[model samples]
Target: MEGFPEKGIKMGNMTIKDIAKKCGVGVSTVSRAMNNHPDINPKTKELIMKTIEEFNYVPNNSARNLKRIQSKAIAVLVKGIGNTFFSDIVSGLERECQKKNYSCILQHVEEQEDELDIALHIIKEKKLQGLIFLGGSFSHPKEKMEQLEVPYVLSTIRTAGENCEQYAAVSVDDFKESYKMTEYLLQLGHERIAILTAPKEDESIGKLRLMGYAQALKDKKIPVQEELIGYMDAKKDRYSFQTGYKLTKELLKKTDFTALYATSDTLAIGACRALKEAGISVPDECSVAGFDGMEAGEFYIPSITTIRQPVEKIAKATAELLFDMIKGKEVPRQLVFEGELLERESTAFSSCHESVK
Candidate 1:
């Protein structure tokens, strides 16, 4: 090094040679001191470390992690990050990941197809350790996930198809939950119970939920009326309040149902609004209930009776499954949770008829 300093190598703005000269030591001594070598004096090592900090020395994370061979970041892909349902799940996921010293990166792919593409890209490019698929169904075929060879967990409200055995999933027993809700309404002396649900045959959950509604009526010896069933495509709006509002308005004009079981809280809330505006009393003129005990449902005028899914538990279980898969542990292919019915002011005895007019 021309005069041992002209090379311009610096540590904390002081050239390595300058540090060595200042400590009355050789360049080897300075290097050892900076690296905290056992041969270096404690005072020298402290001075070197302090100088590095004072000068705002930055280490390259990529280079550092290259030595570790693995990243601690996990990727989360969902339909919409703004949705409260997804937010609650994310909260649970973050809690679990934090405890395990892993960072979570959330990505919202509005389209299902796009989400599949991104998930594949993340596995190949970002080298993500694991992925958590939240809310919506995967657009790609189940085989694609197996082909990509990545650890993933699905936390959608619905269960996956038969081909989705490679990944783990957490979902509620939609059929049993919906059937129980319908049975409860029927037990309350409701004969004309209507179901607002997404199209059947789209997935097991949707079809099973609708089946439960139909079965409950059939079990009680009530004839199944095709007119009482409202079908929407979850792939299409998935039962928004506006969807509920419009559908209920139409249903009221077409049929006189005594009770309504909406597939989602948003739909039920919309239904309630439409009924109130039409001078129809809730639980009196029409007993209303919904799935997914969302917080907004509780504060709605008269509140909403709903089947409450264990969203947090689902999230936690989903994360744990993915974590196990990431660590090369075998997990169950399907994990199903039960839902609880939260009876509230929105539902009442069939005889409690208080006219709004």
Candidate 2:
């Protein structure tokens, strides 16, 4: 029989550590191989599995619940339900989980719901090994975070008014990217530039982007006009197409500007629809630009000029950091990526600017 030795080891005598030692690999590596994680080298994984079978090793039972077998799984808390910008990031995270042989659970939190509370509940219910928070703002009290015993990462989201030293985060610098976009529009000779932004009370990336726009106008010696700034409704708008259209329509009724900068591609596309209905030509009568380069914006009739965030890079980094944390090989840290500006069809030199120059 090609199986256990004739002089068999006692049942449950071989622990994971013993298996790992027999396989000449780390405990984590052995665990990954046992779980069929793709990150492990194929030959090494085969060796580890063969050793496990030869040793008659059995995995440990979870202390949390004696009746249930603990799984190597993680959860991702997605704040915005229908936000397209988060779709690709979510998919990337799922792929990473597959490589690590961990199951990924995607849970969406409502606009007014508390994400941390949701996270705590899910961690307990699913016996999650780790977690990732995607989208939304995080400014919870330090003690609240302490309640989460499992390793976690903040992906594509910024914490406001918090000591970030104790958390791991992967994201683009929203303020810097927003500033770059605003400056680009300004250089195109748009003096009376308008912005479609987050609600006034927003404290996360929305607030950062808005600040970038204000600072850019200030640096240019252009007085910021309150009338030209459009704010979305917190209750009804989840950065959707309708929100963008509605905000632009309201801005059109109140002010006349040469350029419109939206904080997201979804909002920019919505603004374009509104502008089209009002008989204003994009880059002819008014220019439009956006942030978070979504695919829809690229194929729009008047392609959007926007800041393209490195979503795939951010997502991969987030998975690596979270896994490192879980392995006790890394401490809390922040990773900020730079965005690229793609100047496309929607923005151009202002007609008034040419006349003035």
Query: What does candidate 2's lDDT look like per residue over 1-357, in tens digits?
Result: 123333365645667777777678999999899777889999999999888777677776565345444557889999885889999899999999899877889999998788999999999999987999987767788899999989999998887566776788898888889889999988888999999987787877888898899999899999999999998777678777888899999999988999999999989999999999999999799999988888988999899999998989998999999989988998879999999999999999988889644
Candidate 1 lDDT trough over 10 residues, lowest sum = 1-10
TM-score, predicted candidate 1 vs. hidden true structure: 0.76
Full-model lDDT, candidate 2:
0.87
Please provide, for model 1 over 122-211, each residue's C-alpha lDDT reduced to its tens digit, 9 standing for 90 to 100.
877776788888765444566565665677787855553666554577888888898999998887778888878775545545676888
Q: What clash pairs does model 2 have?
A: none
**Worst lDDT window (10 residues) for model 2?**
1-10
Per-residue lDDT, model 2, residue 242, is 82
lDDT values of the candidates?
0.75, 0.87
**How far off is residue 144 in model 2, in Å?**
2.4
